[model samples]
Target chain A: MKVKQISVFLENKSGRLATVTRVLGDNGINIRALSIADTADFGILRLIVNDPDKAWQILKNNEFTVSETEIIAVQVPDKPGGLASILETLEKSKINIEYMYAFVGKSGENAVVVFRVEEIDRAITFLQENGIRLLTGKEVYTF
Target chain B: MWNREMETIPRPQLEKIQAERLRKTVERVYNNVPFYRRKLDAANIKPEDIQTVKDLERLPFTTKQDLRDNYPFGLFAVPREEVVRVHASSGTTGKMTVVGYTRNDIGTWSEVMARTLGCGNVTEKDIIQVAYGYGLFTGGLGAHYGAERVGAMVVPISGGNTKRQLQVMVDFNVTALACTPSYALYFTETAAEEGIDIRSLPLRVGFFGAEPWSHNMRKEIEEKMNIKAIDIYGLSEIIGPGVSSECLEQDGLHVWEDHFMVEIIDPNTGQVVPYGEKGELVFTCISKEALPLIRYRTRDISILYPDVCRCGRTHKRMNRVMGRTDDMLIIRGVNVFPSQIESVLLEIGETEPHYQLIVDREGNLDDLEIWVEVSEKIFSDEIKKMEELENKIKKEILSILGISARIKLVEPKTIARSEGKAKRVIDRRDVYTK
Candidate 1:
């Protein structure tokens, strides 16, 4: 139930984000879901890609500081209280979410939310016991 | 005219006094300090052989590494009881170059500092404000004692507290100021912001040292504060800020040859350079009682002129220090080395070993910004984690170096990889120009 995410360290300068996307696109690596965490001086570009290992290698070879992280993609109902209910479940179990971002899936009835939690295995087990669907690495990469 | 007899002693008479003092210091160190004893024995030289100041070259040169090897209290000629004070400055590593002073040694320091203030003709009627930081660094108490010895009312206001400094300067009618040249410039700006015209004040002279500054900076400070700026020079390894000072003429700083014997030598060849030529400065503390150094290499580059100054002081005058032979950087009167910063990063084990130190002057104070390349091993998807890494590096550097530096995390290949000696320091302060 773990998905590999590619995170690139981006300096707060013009065209850096564009350069990262261009590098991945030219190498045929499709970015499925992405979010940027920014500050006044720098930003972190977190990405879920079709081929994470390939994207990581390409970014590293291109002189960008990149790393691989493990996150979970959960299929939540496409409704207002969908994320709130999952968050409430995790909060009851005391599993801390470091960061989270959402993306609309091809199936209009559901949405995929990427969560980076502190206790990955415990979070996966607790969420599964609560009858929530967790997308595997292969399923998320292919989708 | 503090100690006018020694300051104006004839060249021949000064040389005789130096020879006599040199002989005594060599004998004292050889007998008391085991480190110097081993050094002298390894060189196959005896105390009796060093008859005059010219024989100083026969002795082995003492480097900062030697000081570190001895650690604390290893180089003092006097016993622990006789040593009354100790002052230390940061070394290139975690260890510090420690120095001790005896009662007589403190008296000697006061005498030289008095001469330093006397260069500006500071008298008892003048109220001197000693702005140099007063702890182990020696600038504070060194100037304080000298001003008191001159019978001047001393305001022992240590460094920092800018507004308080200005208030004391005005309320006390300070006539002389002693501090770093950069701080003097900073005071001018602060005075203007507070709408206090410093030119209209009674502040007349400033003794600036503990860092290398340019002639242009002197002109700027003099113009801004309407004060005669004099350059003073010294190190904790020697007797703090009293080794030499520029007279009112402002031509060159006069080295007190009667107390400290000065020499200029080719840094690579170790051969004595001709007079008026630039070389590494080396001093042998001839009159010091506690921490007597024999041919201690200062690593500062400058020239020595035997010509007597027009100020009637026969002591040999040396030009302002041009640069250092090593990569040590002085930021706001504190010693900083690139290797020290490297050691700090290595200990943290968070960032890559590749880094660069950028020293720049912002509004009359030195600012150090460190550019460290982020490594993939420590990079995180969470921005807070990355910020924590930067803060950890900054805190470690501050704890080790005693100065706060802005840690800038850049991309992996942002710092250029060099095949030769890596360029580690980028000094944009422009304070070292002649």
Candidate 2:
């Protein structure tokens, strides 16, 4: 299953992160999950949002460099070996993950793990065939 | 002195030779070159009418556009067989300003270069390294011939390769260096970085030219490299790197009056100015055969001191070239036109037209950073995409300008817009200069 994520480019100036979030918040767009990749010169803010298309539009209107990327969200058992098991399966299948982040689901027994990989369709087919639960975009957004 | 008789020749005798050479040069150009013949005819002046250096004012002035109009070989006075060498400068509009030299002309250049190197006290005992770039540019070979003429051990180690340049300077015990003043300072920094003690090296004299530098830069170079930094001035169109040079006195560069007739004219009015007045420097190549340029306007702004120098040279001297009437930036001895930068940006189609070039001196080296505005569509949130665009723009600029620059992409509206002509460059190094 694939989910839509919005990313914004921010120059490493003071209050740039605040500016990006303020722009999205002012447009009534809620950020569900977020991660930041930063360097000395600039930073990239990635967000799983309620409406990624609306978020991209509002950020673009605010003159922020924003893009939409397709990522997969997997349901884990919230155990110590949950992420390790999924990673092992992906490794065996020769699927490389670009980046990953996690959030605990409302059920408290499972976790939602977001992944960015180059081959989304192959990873989806492999993971589904391996009996790994892949949340749909609608389910991830609602969660 | 390389040639004591010529260096200290009396003013009257020098002027006499200048007058005779000027007459011969004008007569040759009038009969051979159609461009000069037309120019002289349009000015209603004949070659016989030019008997003295003072009579040169009556002739029509030649601009760089005239050279471009002539193109590759349109202004040569001699046949193609007699021409020995050719040099060119990057043209403003993508065509080169080409110049040629005959055997005798090369001899004249070498002679002037000998005098120039001799001014820096380069003797037969000294080991000289010519660090100026060789090829179609006049810097390297010009210094090479001059160093050889002085009977010095010449090392034809052209430009770049900082590590090798330093190693050669140490291993060969180089006593003299001929390169751009900025590069000499850059070498000093690199030597220090490599744990080499440049001050302990045998570098006694440094002949630096091909770009305008300040007296403070002279001090920096001398103290850092422990060498006597001498300023040498010339252009490819006007016989390359040995037109004039500062003697030991370091007051002004002595223009060998016997070969070149120098004049100062107000750039705005195009009229001759009094001696010691600041104006555009013009030269008439009295001894040049292949390219006998007459009243060729050198856009460099400086004053002329015809008085004899304290170093006992009776040749007329010109002050250091300070500013230019036009916008030509000399970055690390490379000629960079702002229009070239604009053309590269337009060709890449990644950035907006609004850009600013920030030039600064970082640790005695010239640092160039170009601030280009990116269109909203091209600005990518992905780090790899953004870095790719930056590298692409940098490669394009380097290929077009032949100079490296740090590419900085800013927001579209960050650069201030102008109502008239845009302000393209912010030179922070001007504070060190007058």
Candidate 3:
């Protein structure tokens, strides 16, 4: 299953991140999971939001460099080795993960981890063949 | 002096020579180049009307746009077969402003460049390292030919490779260095970092040009390297790097009036300013055969000094360039236009057209930072994709402009939006000459 993610380009200036969050918050768009990849000069803020299309629009209207990307959300057992187990499975299949971030689901027994892998279809098929549960876009948005 | 008789020719005789050469150049261009013929015809001026050097103002001024409109080989008076070499500088767009030289034209360049080196007393016994970039830019091969003509051992090291340059300087006993003034200073610092005392080396003189520098920069370089720093000036359109050069006196750059007729004109009005006034420097190639540009506006702002220098050269000297009429930035000796950067961004189709070029001097070298606004079409969640886009932009700019620049992907609306004209350049470097 493919999940929608929003990414914003942020310069390493004061209050840039705050402005991005404030723009989304004022528009009533909820950010579900977020992670920042930063360098000395600039940063890339990857976000999973409740309403990605609305969030992307509001961010674009606010003059933010935002993009919508399709990432996969996987449900893992709520334990210390949950991420390690899924990573081991992907590593065994030789699937490369570009980046990943995690968040605990509402059930409190499972965790949701967003993964951006190189080959989406192949990874999706391989993970399904290995009996891994993949959450669809709607499931992640409501969670 | 390489040619002492020509260098110190009397004013009246030199004017006579210039008038004769100018007349011949006008006749040749009129008969050979359709562009010049049409321009002269449109102005209702004939070649015979330009009988004296004073009549030069009657001719139409050729701008860089004219050269671009002609493109490659469009303005050459000689046929393509007779032209021995062609060098190009970056135009305002993607195309290059190409210049051609015949065999005799090359000889003229060599002779003038020899005189340029001779200004600093470069002789046959010296070992010279021509450190300017070689191909296309006209600095390296220009100084190379001159050093060879002076009967000196010419080490065509070109540019970059600081460690090897120092090794060759120390091993080969380099007596003279030819490069941009900034690079000469950079080399001095690099030499010290490597524990190579460049001052103790046999490096006696430096010929620096291609970009403008200050007298204070000269003093700093002279002190750092223990060498006599000389300022040489030229452009690709008008026979590079030997148009004018400062002799040992270092008072002002003595324009070689025998080959090039120099004039200071009000850039806005196209009228000649009185001598010793600040205006755009224009040149008429009096003796060139291939591309004899007549009254070509150089856009460099400077004053002309008509007094005889202490070096006894009778050619009128021009003060160091104070500024430019155009927004062309000379970054690391390469001509970079803001429009060129805009064209690059437009071609890439990834970033917004709004951008700013930040030019600053880091240490002794020029650093160019391009801040381009990231558009929605190019932004991605992956950092690797963004980095690839940055590299692509950097590579495209390098291929087009011939200079490396740091491509900074700034957020949209980060670059200030002006009301009328978007201010595209932020030059933080100190204005030392002014």
Cα miss at B285, model 1 (Å)?
Answer: 0.5
Judged by DockQ cut-offs, the docking class of candidate 3 is medium
Candidate 3's displacement at residue A73, Å, is 3.2
How does chain A of every candidate compare to the true chain A by TM-score?
0.97, 0.95, 0.96
Give the TM-scores of the predictions, in the order they appear.
0.98, 0.80, 0.92
lDDT of 2 at A22: 85
- Score each candidate by Cα lDDT: 0.91, 0.86, 0.91
Report model 2's TM-score to 2 decimal places: 0.80
Judged by TM-score, which candidate is best? 1
Q: In model 1 chain A, where is the ten-residue run with the lowest total lDDT?
A: A102-111
Error of 2 at B59 (Å): 3.6
CA error at residue B179 for candidate 1, angstroms: 0.5
Evaluated at residue B105, the lDDT of candidate 3 is 89
- For each of the candidates, what fraction of the native contacts does it recover? 0.80, 0.23, 0.88
lDDT of 3 by residue, B1-434 (tens): 99999999999999999989999999999999999999999999999999987899899999899999999889999988999999999888889999999999899999999999999999999999999999999999999998999999999999999899999999999999999999998998899899998889889999999998877888899998999999999988999989999999998999999999999999999999999899999999988888999899998999999988999999999998888898988999999999998988888785458789999999989999999888877777788888888898899899989889999988877787678456899887654353
The residue ranges of model 3 lying beyond 4 angstroms of the native Cα positions read A79-98, A117-138, B431-434
Per-residue alpha-carbon lDDT of candidate 2 for residues B1-434, written as tens digits (9 for 90 to 100): 89889999998888889889989999999999999999889988989999877798888888888999999999999999999899987776567789999999889999999999889878899999999999888999999998888899999989999899999999999999999888898898899899999999988999999988988889989898888899999987789988999998999999977888899999988899999899999988999999989988988898999888999999989999978877778887777777777877777664547688888888767888988766655665456777877888789777766678998876545666678455888887772255
Candidate 2 vs candidate 3, lDDT winner: 3
| Prediction 3: B-chain TM-score | 0.97
